[model samples]
Target: MELTFLVYDVIIQVYAMLIRVSSLFNPKARLWVNGRKGWRQSLKNKVPAGGVDIWMHCASLGEFEQGRPVLEALRSLYPEKCILLTFFSPSGYTVRKDYPIVNHVCYLPLDSRKNARIFLQTIKPKLVIFVKYEFWFHFIREISKQQIPLLLISALFRPGQLFFRSYGKVFKQSLLSYNRIFVQDKNSLDLLKNTGIEECVIAGDTRFDRVLTVMEQSKEIRAIDTFLQGKSAWVAGSTWPPDEQVIRGCSDLISKWIIAPHEIKEDHLLYIEKLFGEKTVRYSILKDAPEKFTDKTILLIDNVGMLSSLYRYGQAAYIGGGFGSGIHNILEAGVYGIPVVFGPKFQKFKEAKDLIYLQGAFSITLENELKDVIVRLGNDLFSKSAGDICAHYVHEHAGATEKIIRFIQEKRFLTN
Candidate 1:
């Protein structure tokens, strides 16, 4: 415990300095928002105090989406309970700043003993939920010490995973504190047994359930509607710079394309503009640009909060960040019934391999291969074959949410 505190102290100082120098406002400013009544008062705008408080913690934006169904269930089942969400990253916090379900959203401070205590004290949650892979020892210890229930949702584990391995004693022991663990796959169950912590259930991934919900609610874009009046559209979602470079290499004579980067920055927009300078790049939301896209390339996605929805507008899809070891959610594309394409390096993502073996998704090792695949998809011989197979693959794997929601409700955690 002392060693952990020492490590945390050393880490938080550097974090504080980073926050000071960085451009964005620190979302965890509330943790240090004590002693100054005005600042403390402003940082933590008042939240409902008397309701059954349920606090959910996520590592980032993806996990937040994974936790959405559970959040929705709680809201529907116990409307009186005040839901609070804390994100460990700016991406999640910024993306979900206006999420309808959560009353209070803020950054989980760099976990130190003092910050942990203050956070738990303020939220005073009846239950604490950790989505997927955020296993903070101090946070869990504080929740356990406060005699509140802690749950892990949609979790996965493997044989060589540190928790089950010989050296994972301390981390494994820390997990024993949770009242229950709801894992996504059976492999996780097998791994947990090796640790002798058998109080877990195969609850499946809630993200599938969430993504299905997204598919059900997905809206077609007006600009895409105009662009794809006749031609089949290839959509790219959450791509990075390398992904954009590959997209730009595609010939302008192809049917039509929508390129949505994972980021929508001024410099990124400029880089994309430089690449597609002659072709038209539409600002998705603004839509006030020139009228050259009828025979041109649509380069930049100046819009925010709409990439997931835009995947619904394509016959073929390419998810971003594959080139830089960051695989965006292929399942988002999968759910839309589109044959997905991505870069070669996707070993860390099990779904990528699953999609590849299922005989529809393509993993290209070279940019030329990407060009070849695009050209092939344009050909009349093999378009619908892969598209139908991809759709079938996603259709068969859609019940991860039902498993998780049933577990949470049965345990009576969200019940007021």
Candidate 2:
């Protein structure tokens, strides 16, 4: 264990150094490095002394959404407790730093023994919750040492993950630090139990509850409505260049298109405009001059924080990122009862796999496959059937948030 800790420390140091170097060229990395600067002082100033804090850490914006339902529930249940939310990635922190629910939001410093100890000492949280795949050894160990109630929520475990491997004893031992692990699926529970770590339960995914809430709270975007003009469009969300290439090839099949690319930088926006030609109009421009874009068929969303709501404006949706790593959130669109299409690399996401099996979603590699799926979804009967599957799937998976909250109350993790 000592040797493993030494190796882990070396790896963490190397990773920190890499991030520092990468900050020179990478915008995200720059934000990451800069966010941690004077983190101790920042915590001291923001987090009040002697108040009970419930700390939740998310790796990125996605995990934040997954844990949001529980956070909101906790807020309603225990309004007196301070909610300190931390993000490991700038992608999460930059977007949600001003999130209204949490009392404070800040960047989690790099996972070093010293940083973890100092951070825990400063906050002195009564409960610590880690969303999804965050398993920082030092942070978990420090929290456990302090005997703070630590919970891992909306967690998923795959057979190929490090925790199940022979060399993963050190990593596996970290799981014991958590007071309870609320997993997203039964497979995760089974895997943990098989490994002799029994403090876990299948609480489904809180994102299901989140999407449903979002759907209920969603308001109309006048520009999107004007662009579609009663014509049903297909929304391509979080698209990469590869996803765009495929969409471009099948452009003729799609009547009205709404594309929300993953990166909305000037270069990427210009690239999308060029790729889609003159027919493409930016959402910002369309909002100001809706009449000028009356003839434009492709509406490009060159922004963030709107993709989830934008899914409602489409008859079908294509979630991107599958061609590169994996697909972005399909549930956001699926909850809207739309047939979702994505690239072939979706093995890691259990929701994607479930949707595909239920015929609610389609995974395609080639442009022709995309065209075919688009055409198939154009059929009202087929589209409705597939769409029903998606909506039902989302609704069925709801209440994970409630389950997690019930457990916390039952276990007395948080006092009233």
- Model 1: lDDT of residue 236: 84
The Cα local distance difference test for each model comes to 0.74, 0.92
**Candidate number with greatest lDDT:** 2
Candidate 2 per-residue lDDT over residues 326-405, each given as its tens digit = 89999999999989999999998998999899899999999999988988888999999999999999999999999888
lDDT of predicted model 1: 0.74
Q: What is the C-alpha local distance difference test score of candidate 2? A: 0.92
Candidate 1 TM-score to native? 0.87
- For each candidate, give its TM-score against the true structure: 0.87, 0.97
List the candidate 2 regions with Cα displacement exceeding 4 Å: none
